[model samples]
Target chain A: MIDLFLFGIFPYIALVILIGGSIWRYATKQFTFSSLSSQFLEGRLLFWGSVPWHYGIIVILIGHLIGIFIPSGVMAFNRIPLRLYILEGTALALGLLLMVGLVLLLVRRSTSPRIRRVTSTMDIVLLVALLLQVLSGIGTAVFYRWGSAWFPQTATPYLWSLATFSPKVEYVTSLPLLMQVHTANSFVLLAIFPFTRMVHMLSIPISYLWRPSQIVVWYRRQAR
Target chain B: MDVRAQVATVFHLDKCIGCHTCSIACKNLWTSREGAEYMWLNNVETKPGTGYPTQWEDQTKYQGGWEVKGKSLKLRLGRRLGVLSNLFFNPNLPIMDDYYEPWTYTYEHLFNAPPSSEQPTARPISKVTGKFMDIEAGPNWDDDLGGSPVYARNDPNLADLSDAERAALFRLEQLVFFYIPRICNHCLNPGCLAACPSAAIYKRAEDGIVLVNQDKCRGWRFCVSGCPYKKVYYNWMAGKSEKCILCYPRMETGQAPACFHSCVGRIRYLGVLLYDAERIEEVAKSPETEMVAAQRSLILDPKDPTVIAAARMNGINDEWIGAAKKSPVYRFVKEWALALPLHAEFRTLPTLFYVPPLLPIAASSKRGKYDLTDGEFFSSLEDSRIPIRYMARLFSCGNEEIIKTAIKKLWAVRTYMRAASVGDISDQRATSAMSELGCTPEEAREIARLTSLPRWSDRFVIPPYQREDVIQQLTSPIGHKAQVGFGSNVPVRRGP
Candidate 1:
């Protein structure tokens, strides 16, 4: 019953909150949408913490996304022992890098009095949750030994079931405690995403690459 | 010709008395918020002293404005991709220490203190930390060259001066400094507009006032570092960058900006300047020595039939054209050529101009008696306490001749006025001084009148914003009337 509720109904609840809350927040209080950067208050440690954290987490999330989208491709690549080792090794290094970056960020938040003054409750919650998620992910990779191989078989099917509006608890029911924690905590992150600075991830500003450097806004149309 | 009407300014530095009434008025009207205590939208700083952000003119440390590479221009901060990569952590952004930590006295301590032998004191507290703190510095800490040895000695403009000249600047008998009031330049090529990753900062097409869209700004902070003058400020509480909006709401109603309205010395002149937008980049790319002249050439003469026709074709109304005809800025910047843009080498093509100050004549003591006459009448300019080279560095981008001409013209006006009113100097001597700069007696009288005795209307020739026409095009004017007002409808707050 717990597995059915945790793995089946809870994902839908998290998704509803994630989508609805983000839209509502965006429509009602659009001004609140920002990274709320504390770099101006304290930049040196922020440079050390923020840069690595973004780079490492972005790559790791992309890897996870790829596993969900093309499980067959991941399985095909994992067929060779050498290729599997290389893939697993790279993932482990990146996960470690993410961990190191998160630790530095946590230290910066706690030690710097200036940053601490501006640190909100949601900021602390998000940072702690991210640290736990990364730790459990590293834990699952270490003990289970071949997450790249097993993730496609188990988590992807379960995620697809959630997406397709069908419950599939058996796929992830028997997973190890660390893997289960990793999966559950990700949903927690999604549920709380709208209320945190993490929403800045959605605002990547890739359009700036093509947009003209100079922007002139006109209240009235000008004749060319 | 891509003609655009810009409401520009000319600040006569000689008339400024270093009063901060403009700063106070601006603060009370706009930036008395929690996050904006440190921000002074308009600040007057004594020259030969480091400015508010402490050596903001030194671009090497801040990496602001733009740089010329071959024929094209790029942000001195970096390219677009570089800005994206550094979005998470901007290395060039100034810390609070650089701009001085804003603070307020604990006024409640006076009322709430327990009975004591000594008088109760309202100790200083940090606005950011909300704790008792030692006050070290402020926005105008170096006002009137207060810390001359430390702040004035470290001025970036003093880089080219010799040791003797530098020493002479600080000597007791030769001390000289002038006040320079600064606001956003609203440049033809604004570096802040170019550096924004979110495309949040923009210049208004009608009036050329640069503004940051609060809803779109995501606190990347590149705008703060990108502006060469360091005018853009990051509101830590709002998580958005803010700058001088040139008081658009007030301007739309045809009133002068608060700073211009409240200027105690009446040194500020506000008027519409019609300029060709097509040549902004070409003029910004001019060599350092030729930058002042290049920028002057950018301003289209409002009286020119071709320019008026182009402006009409471009949809600039008749009122703005008429205002441009009577523009004091046009006379100061183009006709008289007395005012020049500050730091023209920054290459943003700043629209704000300054008529550089003429310092007190350098006098000598002859055996305990004063000898005020230092040879020829205008030759006193050569021996003035403040060197022309320093003023050139501040205004003309290392071109001494531009500063000399401006000072000579101003000296002629002063001489002409003294002959007419005080009768201390002969009219023949004053006319000779005026003739050197090719100034007629009538022109000198006009210059003297405009500089010292002009009325408010003559000082600020504000063009009608015609906001109703703009509102009609965007939405129903009736619907816009319900929403049109000063201050934001939405509360500006920081995100989690």
Candidate 2:
């Protein structure tokens, strides 16, 4: 039952909804909120609020990348034995920071008349999804521990199976359902990447450093 | 770097009287804001003295631009290099406060004290509120660019005098300096457009105008630093960057850009030229010697039948193509066998062309100073002491070969403009389309004439975007959430 739910069912549902839904959102003309004025922050509440939350999530994401992408064998040879502990600690701190920041951001968005008017229902749900991921990741990292010699390598492969549509849940079963939910929300974010301002990440400006601040003048005269 | 249209500019330094009308015009049109009160986009400076932003050209102190080391082009300083080019130093970028002080005005004394009228009849006395506002100086304020306390010694044109002569000239305080006019280059390969991670800034396919789509901007300032020219400014108040729009709105109509229309010197021209877009990368990557070779191949002779055909497909016309083919401007800018990039080492292939200044006949003759003598209007053909001409060359190409060729490329613009004004329509089809679009026949004729001329400046008109297409794009939600298949009812488990 656990296998069916974690691997077979959850993976398939996530793949379709996260990936397919995002593509459709971008293609279809429903409700979009994009404007030049979105970056204006009227008060300190909004400024301090969003800064920490967004930063926390970014930090957590970086930790995850380092842990998953770096090969364990290479890490072992390099004598980097405390990698998990470091990542776990960072995840916990960032998770707490994220929650605090989210509370501030959400409160401002909700209570402030102007911000409330601008925010949509979807924005709320997206924030909630991120919150759930933060909470679950922090909870698992703090409560669960593997022996120093043995590293659990099943979570990522199980994730890959779901990504590829061949969900196998036996290894992931050891993980709390909350952890599965957290990972699942991450996929949802990925699916939405192309359809949101998140797409700004892919831009390339080759001459970013040399932009000068001067006026360019071109002249012409009457044909004489 | 496959630019559809070749955008270029030619500045006649000798013609500029430095009245600063152009700077005022641009400031009124754009940067009249509380935060931008001190920002002067086009201020002229005395070279040897402190400049407005204080030593902005000292790149050793403020590191910017790309440096090639074998194969890797890396960021010199900042977390972006150490952190996978994704993370960077926090946006609290080093500011003027770190270097100097900022000053502000206060008018509180008027209310605090009583003033006197008539032989000092008492009523409300005013004083300049002595609140010491910390005024932080910018990076380019030190070298005053040969203005104000001006003399032969400090002047670029007069830097060769004996030390004693230079001292005598300075003792007399005999030099007068004024401001220069400026605007966006809208470069062939715009740094701002390239640096945008979101690809929000785009160079128009038809006009080579670079613009930023406000709705698509995410407030990332990669373009701010990326542009070696620093033409792109960060609008901190708006959270988005802003730049000179090239007056596309005016261009769409049968008019010139505001700056050109309002210019007192009449030194601007507008025309079209064809270039191979695929060669930009080659020109950008090639060594100095190879770059000229690459560009020579790419600069098309618009009069050639094959080139004309290709240009026409891209919306260029015969009248314009013909004028460009015959244009001395074209030969000087491209074929002069000497047109070089302003800072070729920067790697951004800018399209603006500049003709270097002709050195004055006498090394020291201050002849023929003609004053309008009528309400601050005056010009002189003789005073070769002023280095405005040399300044123009400096702004365009910093190399000697390009400079010499540019000086010889005269009358190209004049001939083209004359040919255009008389209804020698460059592209008749475009003219007819202008008429169809509700423009007066006279306006259409002028566009045909102006565009056909082999010059780079002309009166401009704005083009129209597809309203329905833009509306649809604006109304759509970027990210949407919809329920899909069944929920995964996996049992909740605690960590072992």
Winning candidate number (lDDT) = 1
Model 2 agreement with the true structure over B1-496: per-residue lDDT tens digits:
2224444444444345555566676567555553343344544444334343343333344343444555544332332433224322223222323223223444454455565663432232111112344343533343333333432233343333456544443442333333334466666656566556545577766556677665445456556556655556644333455676665544544445556666676545444556777665556566543444455566677666777677666554444455465444354455443234444445566664433333332222235553323221112222323343333324432333444333333223322333455544354533443343344455434433433342433322122333332212222111111111012121211100
Cα error of candidate 2 at position B482, Å:
37
Candidate 1 lDDT, A23-74, residue by residue in tens: 9888887788777998889888788788888898889989999999999999
Stretches of model 2 off by over 4 angstroms after superposition: A1-224, B1-3, B33-87, B90-180, B288-297, B315-341, B357-398, B404-496
DockQ of all predictions against the true structure, Cα-based:
0.69, 0.06
Cα deviation of B195 in candidate 1 (Å)? 0.4
What does the interface RMSD come to for each candidate?
A: 1.9, 13.6
Q: Let me know the DockQ for model 1.
A: 0.69
Instruction: Report the C-alpha lDDT of model 1 over B219-323, residue by residue, as the tens digit.
Output: 888998899999999988878888997877777777788999999899999999999999999998989999999999999999999999999988899999999
- Candidate 1 positional error at B100, Å: 1.1
Candidate 1 Cα outliers beyond 4 Å, as residue runs = A221-224, B365-379, B472-488
Indicate which candidate wins on TM-score: 1
